[model samples]
Target: MRRLFPALLAVAAALAAAFLLLPLVALFARVSPGTLVVRAGQGAFRDALVVSLKTSLIAHAIVLGVGTPAAYLLATRRFRGRSLLVGVLELPLVLPPAVAGISLLAAFGANGLLGGTLDALGLRIPFTQAAVVLAVVFVASPFYLRAAIAAFEAVDPRLLEASRTLGAGPGRTFARVALPLAAGGLAAGSSLAWARGLGEFGATLMFAGSLRGVTQTLPLAIYAELNVDYPVALAIGALLVLVSVAVLLVIRLVPSWTRFASIWPTASAASSSR
Candidate 1:
């Protein structure tokens, strides 16, 4: 019975892998390496690529700065409505991108929930690069925070106590002890956040609009190309596939990163013993 189950599981996995990868294989097969190079060099493709990279990177920075703290707070403390807060933080992950767009628009639009307040302050947010960043952050940050909270929670409380007993201040202990122990997990989570942000589409389009050289990111351009040009769409799709593969590879590479991060402290402890 056990042997049969293993064999059945293997068959299922193989079927799933084939189902997912066959389309990608066909798409890549359609593009010769030469055509890829040509498209990559074209101004529109290159510009879109640059915009995607910039916005995704900025979104990632925002996540790391904001989500990391939020995760830490969730991990280390218990308080009223903590779980509720976590739910709210992760709500975007479940939202349809178009709904998320409308939600943002209603909250921060020119006449939105907070629009009056923002208008009073003479600050503009919608239909801009900042809006793109906001949309990306909205859809992408939860993936990071969830992973990060798990990571921080896994750190040994004893180690933190030891640092405190040895006269480390709260900030020093966090920087010198907690952060090093958790860096690999944080890196893995951050990479995933970046990947999610990079692939963002509907929200960005609705909130930021598809203004070329202003708000037209690669995903936006890909959507635009699908209506008018198939080859351009294919080319953009190919580039996105490449970047997605790279980021997914990094996410899978976390085990190695954890192994490496574990090595340094072990080495130092061994040296002290010697």
Candidate 2:
């Protein structure tokens, strides 16, 4: 039965792949290659791509910079309500993007709870590029944070001790030791966040108006095209799938950074070695 396990898993995997592939195959089959080309050449598509790339990058930066400290604290320390805090951070991960959109509107919309005060400063968040970034961060950061926390948790504690004994500062130890070891997981998680942010539609549509070059990203463009141009929508749909697959595959290619970590077993290792 142990030897037969591989065959069983293979069959399951094949079925899953087919399920995903069939829809893509059908979508492309319905569109002419020429039409796909024309859709790609359009200004809307280019603009959406640019907006997506820019905001997603900004969102990811915020996640990485903020999430690192949070993850590290969670991994190394514990207190009452730590788990609750983590859960709160992760709530957006499982939330429907549309619901998230509505929530954002309630908080930041023109007539939102704090809208009047913000308006006094001439600040408008909803239906703008900044709103899109907030939505992306809300929906996508949890995905990255969950993975990042796990990665930080997996790091050996002893190495941190050893670094301290050697007079290495906290910043240096994190940069040279902890971070290099967790690089692969970070990369994978970052890519997942980017992918989610890229495909985000519900939140983007609800918070930021799908105003072509203004608020529309690729996914929004596809949603818009679907209403009036089925072929164009189909083409963009196929493009999205292609982009997602390409990104995921690239992330999976990163070799593990665990080897560097394996060399450190404890904080006392540095002193003992000498």
Whole-model lDDT per candidate: 0.86, 0.84
lDDT of 1 by residue, 137-178 (tens): 999999999989988888888888999999999788888887
Looking at model 2, the pairs that clash are: 158-266, 158-267, 162-267
Please tell me which predicted candidate would have the highest TM-score against the true structure.
1
**TM value for model 1:** 0.89
Top candidate (lDDT)? 1
- Ten contiguous residues with the weakest lDDT in model 2: 255-264
Prediction-by-prediction clash tally: 0, 3
Model 1: pairs clashing at backbone N, Cα or C within 3 Å = none
TM-scores, each model vs. reference: 0.89, 0.84
